[model samples]
Target chain A: MWEIARSNKRKSVIFVFLMALLLVLMGGVFGEHFAQSAETGLLVAFVIWVILSIIAYFQGRNVFLAVSGAHKIRKEDHPRLFNIVEEMTIASLLPAIPEIYIIDDPAPNAFAVGRKPDSAAVAVTSGLLNTLNRDELQGVIAHEIGHIINRDTLFMSMLGVMLGSIVILSEIARRSLFFGGGRRRTRTSSSGGGQIQVILMIAGLVLMLLAPILARLIYLAASRKREYLADASAAIFTRLPEGLASALEKISVSPIRLRKINQVTAPMYTINPLQNMKLAEDSLFSTHPSTLNRVRILRSMAGGSGYDAYDAAFRAVTGQTRAIIPPSALKTAHATVPSRSRRSDPKSDPGTDQTKQAPSAMGMAGAVLTAAVLMDAAAEPVTPAAKVRETTDAIWKSRGYRFIPCPCGAALKVPPDYRRTDIVCLRCGRKHPAASAS
Target chain B: MECPVCRESMIVIEYDDIELDYCVGCMGVWFDAGEIELMLGKSGIPFPSEALRFRVADTDARELRRPCPLCGKTMQKVCPEHGRVILDRCPAGEGIWFDAGEIREVIKESAGAAGDIVLGALRRYLGEALAEK
Candidate 1:
């Protein structure tokens, strides 16, 4: 794991360095065309890059959470999600558990963010919790943790900031040129170096137009491979490739598109939220491998849930000789997959059994879902409606909505802005006072 | 979100995981498109995509146009087949708006078990607020 993460970090640094160089070149060209000196543009671009990188290093995670409207939740708010995250954290051998957040949107997606593993956070949509089963949810959380462990979050942020700066600089230059603000500078420089100045201006204009697209391609190229690595990491951590494969299937087929996502944050998601369903095939501009390909790779991992197995599966599915997992990481990989029955059997594994017990005990106290329900879920799948309700209830709880349980087995959620002092129960026609209920 | 009918800030009421934005002033309900699909889909009922699709009903031309609570665009009156309940659906497919009495009427007019399940859930939750004529 360390070897894989270290190699990933090394590759990330190279990508960031190359993108930074691209940004500086763009700045220099635009500056020469507009301000008549490459030094000023280069310095300006460098300063912009430094400032943006600093901000991303310190506050990128918070900015992402705020932009996506994710609200942080405590263990009591959503124990199931918290438990899954904790289990994955332990399984991945991380030093600290990442903070958990929930997005209210019904789109089933998730992402991880932070500059370091210890400070990282994982966020999932309410739709995700509502949609996925326990095994599937675990698979998704493990995948996000895969990103954190692989240092993809920090790398992606730095790359995103560089991408942003390139886009902004080019946009400003394009607008300035379009509005004829560069004409005066061109005319002034024309007297000193007439022919060369005209050539330089045209070259700068072309560069400015091509710079953003180039930066986006670089960003997308860097992003797509990391997703496969993370997927492999998730499989090894959970020992359940089917969980992730099915979850990807559900996510890809989901009809609802994420409302709050933008170009910059789109790649951070488990799946590219911005990609249209019809256009989900592999493309130069795509931030992720095609879902079909990813799922096929995971499903075809015949040997075991290991880096070596994933490598073989990748080759089989894509018909490419190139390996996805680093050879060094594969040296220390597990030889065999643990059986599914052993994992499901609470008595067989004490470590996992303890984790399950904690949540079930808490569930008993809250009267949310009893041990019997959990057991039933383990045996036969629970209805999607029940899972959706449980997940949404957690979101409401995090947002300060009060839950009032009625005798008719209905738990009514009263909004914070509910002005009425007394509210009637939606079930059983029983009336309860809002002030006293809380 | 502000109610399109009464223009009053609405209070969200969550029951069985489906959130309904209810206007206290007019007793009207706003059913978001996403939530409706989730509710129907989870319940194993086929989503009434045809009924909810943007179709301008020429019958209610005299009714004042109401802006959709979500997109702020003027909503078109759509009357689902097999029902006389004219609903204000966002042209952008945001959601549907039902006046106080219209919800019950739509439920009554709706075909098969799909309507009964929704009606039962709504009646159980909203009680007299939805039962009122």
Candidate 2:
């Protein structure tokens, strides 16, 4: 195992070294082609590539967060989440605790990015926060920490930068050769420069091909071992492999699939974010290890047996694994729909309490915030239970029963007589149904 | 791992098949050395409403030294987050102990309550946007 790790690391270093060398060599060759031919257009284009890469590097994370709609959190805003993070930081011995952000998505997925532990940021979809119990959650958190501790986050971001840098440079050179230049410039060159143009043309083609190859190579080098490392580290941190193994089992079965993951960031997560994928088929181009394989390794370390004990068990249950669970419905008590439709009241079930609290708490605040965020109405928490009761009654009385202030936030309807029956909201189709049971 | 609060035998309880350490007596949980790190880092689904009412209490105030649940070596209370939630974890990468309700309480506090409000807001925002599942 150590030897495999060593050889892989050596290969990664050598591959990076070779890529850097090729770019430098490719740059020089391209430089000679342009200068000798004296094509003003190509020269200006090459300059632009250098300039843009520098600009994108500093602003990349910001650009991604904004376009992806990530919200930043201060410890005070969500003390519980922040406190847990605070706890994790001390235990991990990390140089920096990553800034936490939530992506307003229902998928139970998260990814860590930035160059290293000090520079990293970990973002989770709201769906993820709503799903796992604390122990399973800890297991997941440990996995992410494993990514950071192993330096995979930094590796990925840097690889993104490098890939971007190379592509920009390559494109500039290619376009300049064809279109002359980005700005107004001299077009025709002396016949003596004809040979140089041929070389420039050839280099442009090579660079184009190298662009994708370069990106893949970086992923191959950055991804493979780091995932294993994070898994091992997560097991080490939790000191209970079953926690993470169980987490993987739940995540595999979750309704919300990872939506934020793309070709660029797909490899950075513990599991491959792209769903409906088989590792054996996609591993050729992918950065993540197979789920079955990971589950097996975790199970081995966990020292116990369960549904995920063997690969066949996981494969049989993991039908189309990429579904992204929704967040908006998560806080609604009515979200636990299965319990609601059961012969008895959903609340009667043992699971309702855990299911209802998250959604209903959100349901109340969400209604308040929804009004605020949508209608531009400023509001605060309704402290008096009467205020809550009043809102619930008003909602109950309103025609169409459009809105529900139930702590679970499910849009509900209660027959005047069955008020005791507690008609819950239809399952928002996220998790189990009615969020109101608790 | 021995329960920090009780110095009693710790039992591992698997909820929903997810393993967690429990104290046989006090019901507090001491998440393994970095277990807190793991839990906090991974995002989870909503906590069941039934699990939310649990609260953490230092069940045993009498004793400090405890036997290592995994290694059988004597263990001491070590502050993981510096006095907030001390741990009875193996100094090595072995497992740790939980005093009965510790795991449940942490899960409840973290997964229940106000955190869900923000998560719900985020969930709606994200859920509707993707509209996938």
Q: Which candidate is the best by lDDT?
A: 1
Over 4 Å off, model 2 = A1-15, A32-61, A74-80, A116-119, A181-200, A253-261, A275-282, A302-438, B1-133
Q: lDDT tens string, model 1, A367-398?
A: 22111212323432388767777787788778
Using TM-score as the measure, the top candidate is: 1
RMSD of 2: 27.0
The digit string of per-residue lDDT tens for model 2 on A1-438 reads 022233334545765665555556556655555544434434444455456445445665666666555676665444445555665566566678878776766666666665556776776656666555455566677778767766656445655555555666667667666775422223434467656666665765676667657657665656765665566555544544566667777776676676655766667555677746543432555676666666666665323221122222224334434211122222332112211111222333433343445545664423211100112222332344323333232322321222223333433332222212222222222222222431
Q: Estimate each model's TM-score.
A: 0.78, 0.47
Q: Give, for candidate 1 chain B, the lowest lDDT window spanning 10 residues.
A: B48-57
Q: In model 1, which regions exceed 4 Å deviation? A: A180-192, A277-281, A333-381, A408-410, A426-429, A436-438, B1-125, B130-133
TM-score of 1: 0.78
Task: Estimate the TM-score for candidate 2.
Answer: 0.47
Per-model clash counts, in order, read: 1, 77
Pairs in clash, predicted candidate 1: A426-B125
DockQ for all models: 0.25, 0.01
Tens digits of per-residue lDDT, candidate 1, B23-115, equal 666778788878766766656667766534444577646668899999999998887676666789888988899887787777666644566
